[model samples]
Target: MKANPGSAAGSPTPVVEAKPCGNTGETVTERALRLRVRQQEILAELGVRALRGTPYPELLEYAVQCTAEGLEAEFCKVMEYVPAENRLLLRAGVGWEPHLVGTASVGADLASPAGFALRTGKPVISNHLENEERFRTPELLVEHGIRRAMNVILQGEGRPYGVLEVDSRSPGEFGEQDIAFLQGVANLLGMAIERQRIERDLRAMVEEREVLLREVNHRVKNSLQLVASMLSLQANATDKPDVRHELREAATRINAIGRAHQRLYRSNDVRVIDLAAYLVDLCADLNAAWPEGEVVARTPDEPVPIATDRAIPLALVVNELVTNATKYAYPGRQDGLVEVCLDQAPEESRVVLAVRDAGVGLPPGFAPHASTGLGMRIVTAFAQQLKAELRIRPLDVGTEFSLVISLQAPDRAG
Candidate 1:
């Protein structure tokens, strides 16, 4: 086989000369000794980069390049292991035939320096590639004119990921110092690969958790719709006008609760709910529950968002106003109007909702707020829950009930 100018094959066609270390003071020996010190420096730099946020795969490349510079060989390669196939695949490498860099691989049990090191979990120092008995492709060595090589296995977290193999065109190219220095480089490489793997796994876990939360929200929406359906059926069974009216109003209120849950449950966020949509839907349901004859409700154009806790009582207030207008305001065949309005009062950091109905004005001695009626009690309770102040004024036609609620901004209609 052709040999490198400065290297010579000391033994036979394939001879692995990993015998023992001896003190040989030559210029090459001194250079190899100096390279050992650099290997330690590279390792220190790699550690600093890891702490300072260098990516994992790039770190692997850096380590592979350092090994190549240290050995000063004709060809240097680092191959990573794939446990499923029990073979080492090339990840980072240098100084090889263009076609061989990524296109070739050596079996773990094959006759190669890497193969030998993997089988025994030890390094293989071959001074003569042609005479190496354990080499899987001794003939390839002759074909590529590779006379000698030195290989070190990188043992990572679980198993040896790859081999760092240094090659030369001549024979007996590496000594004891080369093997020792190469081993240190392999050790640092192993640690970096394992660190990268752990980081990737943690990120994957966080993403998976977020996906599960969205799925949970979807399931909750379905459950709320079922409850609304049952309320609808119950309203159908009642016969008495008073009982039927009460049941229907109850069904409407229950449906509002269900719709609120539906809106909140559909969102990716469980905390804040889109107040505009929920309020529009809820107030519409309230108006439909009992006909106001000429009383129509309206909503704001821009959307507002609010926490679920504040929204619940806010929706119930809307229910009470619509119910009161239907039950008492337009008593006979008199056509009247019940206007519902919501305006964003960000300067005050609150949302104002007012219901105006045209009917017989409140009597001078009439105490609507002091009444024992169930509807009045409910309205007062909900207003208190929102930490809002309720203002009841006698309109020329009927009465106006206005409540101002503390909210984040961008008031939603109700």
Candidate 2:
């Protein structure tokens, strides 16, 4: 090995030998075979890591380091092509200044090894930088005493991403086998980059969809509130008590739906909601609807998440039960307590909702489905919509209504 004057003191400089091409010598062929075996082993390990969900940055950094070690080269780098800027930005490298790894830039011209590989979509090699005439030598390369370089283009999802290059201070360090190994490494890196980009795009799309859903929920809440306001105005203008009562009840039901949508908007997840939290807010609204009753909610520590599709009917059912408790459960009275309970029976794959009022018990021999009241009828219809079994019985001091519905578990990512 000949020592370079520019090398640091006491550091061994690599010898510049004649360039090896084709299958000219047994020495080159044997070395290529050994390198190919090592390359295959490294590629297999990297492929496994990718499948196991290893971080992309860590995998990419390992790839460059693996390439440098496998080919016995002093420097290896992965550059990302920026066509918009007409440049190649260094993304990862081995044996270069630390700041150069992520911040370095080089021109994307025929004169640069990275650019030449990208432009031609093929491999390029310069075994003798001092006397090479095909392209102008980069200043950084000369400064680092680089005597040889080999570059291969990295193709991402059938499009060009950038180039992978290996540099050595020793001339003739790269041969046909080294180029082949770097090609394989570049192909592996391309696949990893493509996967990372796809994952990022999917995340962005989901975020965008969530934002749109929240906006839609806000609009729906406003529209429902507007309808409720119109119904209130009509109720105020009515002369008949029955007509006014019916109009007000209709407005309350609409408002219930609006409140449900509001909860969905605030939760930021349109697909499902924490049933316990939703009921707490809902009962507060119901309690404030009247002047003589208070509604309290009871739930487990763990959240019971129900999908929006099923939640609407469930919300309506609770509304009717609570409304009935406040109105008739304490006939001619000025004070009462209504308790709403939500519990999940995991063993039975069911969710149970019960509304109990500490007021007058059900009238002797009274039937729920046979009731003539609009609220009771609405409750029955909603229970059927939920595919739930409705159960009604008299408590020791009041009436208790229960619904047992099938539970659908949340979906998980694979």
Question: Considering every candidate listed, which one attains the maximal TM-score?
Answer: 2
Tens digit of per-residue lDDT, candidate 2, span 99-171: 9988887777877767888888868777677887777777778888999887889999967889898889964
Best by lDDT: 2
Clash counts per candidate, in order, are 19, 0
Candidate 1 achieves a global lDDT of 0.67
lDDT of 1 by residue, 1-414 (tens): 233332222222221223223565446446545666776776677667756657756776676676667666666777877677767776666665556756566676645567777767767767655556655554445676877677777887876677877777844456555676677777766776676777788878866765675566556556655765676667677666777667777776677676776776566565677777776777667656545364454667776778877777777777777777777787785355677877766656577788888877665786656878888888888887676889888876678888887775334574
Worst 10 residues of 2 by lDDT: 6-15
TM-score of each candidate structure, all chains considered together: 0.59, 0.88
Please list the C-alpha lDDT of all candidates, in the order they appear: 0.67, 0.81
Indicate the residue-level lDDT of 277 in model 1.
76
RMSD of each: 8.5, 6.6
